[model samples]
Target: MPSGRTSARRFRNHVAAMVLAVAATLVSGAPAPVAATGQVAPPATAPSPAPVYPITARIVARYPHDPGAFTEGLLWHDGALFESIGLEGRSEVRHVRLEDGQVLARAVLPADQFGEGLALWENSLVSLTWKTGLAHRWDAKTLKRTGSFRYTGEGWGLASDGKALIQSDGSATLRFRDPKSFAVQRELTVTANGRPVRNLNELEVIDGAIFANVWHRNYLVRIDPANGAVTGLMDLSALATEVAATDPEAVPNGIAWDPAKRRLFVTGKLWPTLFEIALDPAP
Candidate 1:
């Protein structure tokens, strides 16, 4: 009989092997062979589709010189804009005016930690710190540090559904956690057109669907909440090209929706413009 320690080690090794095998299969484009027994064959050995969408997007409004904010997270509540800015020694959470880009209230993070994602739950604001494994909660109205929680992995994106919190790292996985305790409740891998779309970041939950920004790309994907399927894609290539021409470091990384006002907002890292866009399904 195996000892408890040895059994635990073996279990961990098995999990690691499974993860590596999946990664290898994804990268090599080789299908796993099937045996003689009646079993379904593996997927076809083909490269995944490129991370480009063909949907048309029109910018409804754009504001220049919005602090050149290294945007990590964005949210809109009750006619106020909440934004989280990243980079160590320069991280801040600010309440801004939606009409014109003006900081109304702000709270700065410590100098050593880079901010990543944020969400608004109840009356508090929650934010994650990149590489720090720490999540901070603040009083939304006063900007006072209310509490803190710890989580594993690199923080990338966050969203809330008026119940649980949804988060993503740089992987293809989306994790759902309890808001108060910060305990992971469930997880799922995101698939785009039958292929896994990794590097998922900057999340927003709107109308029961998960919308995420694929980091370093000019696309935002609408994911089915139940099975993580890519149902629709929004192409922001024009906005990306324009931002790149003006600022090469600008990368789209924030998304927020105001259901009451029926509006959407998007911005990028170290960007000077925050855009309000109206979404209309293509004919």
Candidate 2:
């Protein structure tokens, strides 16, 4: 359940129409929203806990993963799945096998840093730290630490558009950074139903939208890059029934997409099995 959320706003939104209006406003040639006086209208206030539709995952494949793996970030590229696991002292980045879930190569972070997220560029992998204001660089092929850089705030999640990195810091904002120098290029205030959406974590960029795992909740949202609007929200509460939560750190956090095969995968920290899900295809 989501924490500190008042009970009044606890209901989920079932109507798909909530996203329709926003979609129309974002595309080119759409009419601008205006007040009766012909002035631009203000943003509407969103219901505290936005309504979300429950989406059941279709398990395409299941693999044995280490139960001790505190998965923080996950990605699939060129037939391999790379994972980043976290804890102050046990944080590491791994190159894994999807068929058997074997750790073929690994690079461990120093004891003081808590690993958070990972993103892949051309030949490099960039990893974020929880509170250290730093990001580490690694060779994607060898899992070797190549170098490091810095950011201004906490690093919660990371995704790359192949040229630049998009990052979140447990806030309603997403920052776009230059891959080479890590300098921020732009940012957006992510919103759901016109209200800020915080706790954005574990992002996957596929088919022009950013899919994010909302921390501490059973929601996964698709965000529009142009206006920072959450175009779709899916409830994954039923998935929790499959695993009994025993570890305090266990939570739904990792998300990856296989572009070639058009497969979607998800798993949580300390999860024994990884899931391959078939999402509702867009009309």
Candidate 3:
């Protein structure tokens, strides 16, 4: 699936969860987990133990997505969906049609740099690189790379709060940066049940809360921007299973919010479908 620095931690979290699920089934005489079938099955009854309240992603609509796109970032603004695709030699920023997933326009990055998170700051489309420590600025309307700047450390996910840029680097810490200079202004540590949450990736700022996709996981955590505490955890394990049947690397990693329509969209790396969903309390 995903490699490099975050792979080990991702593997650990995945394996630990699977082990717990299997153990619970063996002890309780419940059905065994379907991990062998390449599906990360959800709990048959109540959700797992976690500090934050459980939320379920109720699919409202589905749309086509580019199965070859290794989606790293996604956002909806005005009336369009902009996505950042990853992988060396294949990275691009695309303006996609919401109805059919047709790429209306795209800007390619250098073959050496793996693209990551994307955000819109004012009239500019800002995108980040994974290991190169470079951030590119693009004209929101033209999709042209206007200029570039440098940043410290790895870039995983990015979002804008209408004032500043919020960035994550696979760590529990989220940095608030000056949108103009891209300088770190403040940092927030995301926590759940007093424990730090790592591998934060693909972000969307809706209303005032920060919605983040935990890398390789089928869920998104909603954090309070004022305090960094996870207020809700929305599970999409069913969708994850559906997407990963053929490719195990198709991990859910994209989130976009359409404020005007009040819709939330989610998809995954190499997925062929994008789902518009609504969150509801889990039973």
Candidate 4:
């Protein structure tokens, strides 16, 4: 059997190959797979869904200036914000004030792992590292490392369904894993307009569907949990692009929903603004 590091490298290579293949297919304009009913089928590629949100969001609050944060995961708990910021040497887990983005507490990771997704489960905080294939568990209060487990592929986004830890690895596939053992329980490929959508990142399990941020895009997709079909898309083009035009790294990545307060918060890599939004249901 290959070592954990070797396995991680192999998974990364496979994902890269898959991405290249997708790009090539799009460029060639080849006919994609069909359902075999003598009708034109949807393209195999997962293109971004058209905006369908009926209600426009009003940004309630914006946190500008935490410009060094390469934000990967964000969650709202109690009255504080729990954020997992990425980039190997600079990765950290922090507790911040929701009102002003003030860092209340923080714990830095080792200088080798680029942190990715995070979630609060039970009484501990769970996090995934992008390249290390490691899932870390930390004390929710102290931010002390309690345990670590290995996973396959590059971890991109993670959320909990109140039972299992749901994860995405920059693929069309979404995986559910046992929180304790980190063993994959089942997987589903996300489809938009009957086509598989890859690069699914920054997830939040809202209501019964999975809301994900498509990397490098200005939209959020709501996917049916049972069938992996995209039900709606929310356009956030206006929020991040204003800054993105000036900053190359201001890519939206973090998403957190406050169920109790009925609010949503989004932020990006090295961005100065954190937006508080209210998602109106699609009509």
List the RMSD of every prediction in angstroms. 15.9, 11.2, 10.1, 13.7
Best by TM-score: 3
lDDT by residue for model 4 (1-283), tens:
9998897567545534444443456446566433122323334354432422223455787775387888889888877789999886999999888778899888888899988899889988999998788899999898999999998788889999899989988778999999889999999889755668866888998887888887765667788889898766665767776666455445788888899988889888788788989765545
What is the C-alpha RMSD, rounded to one decimal, of candidate 1? 15.9
Residue 225 miss distance in model 3 (angstroms): 1.1
Tens-place lDDT per residue, model 2, 1-283, is: 5654443133223324433332343332343344222324223222233443333345677777777898889999768999999888999999999988999999999999989899998889999998889899999888888989987878889999876899988778899999999999999998866777766878999788898887655557788899998766655555655767676456688898998888888888888878788876642
Ranking by TM-score: 3, 4, 2, 1
Question: Which ranges in model 1 have alpha carbons more than 4 Å from their true place?
Answer: 1-56, 65-67, 245-248
Cα displacement (Å) at residue 220, model 2:
0.7
Residue 96 of model 1: what lDDT?
A: 89
TM-score of 3: 0.82
TM-score per candidate, chains pooled: 0.79, 0.81, 0.82, 0.81
Q: Which candidate would rank higher by lDDT, 1 or 3?
A: 3
Q: lDDT of all the models against the reference?
A: 0.77, 0.76, 0.81, 0.77
- Cα deviation in Å at residue 73, candidate 4? 0.5
lDDT per residue (tens digit) for residues 1-283 in model 3:
5665587566446544653452344336455244322434332322234545555456889999999999999999769899999988999999999999999999999999999999999889999998899999999898999888799998989999998999999788899999989989999998765656767889999878999987656677788999888776676777887766476567889999988877899999999999999755333
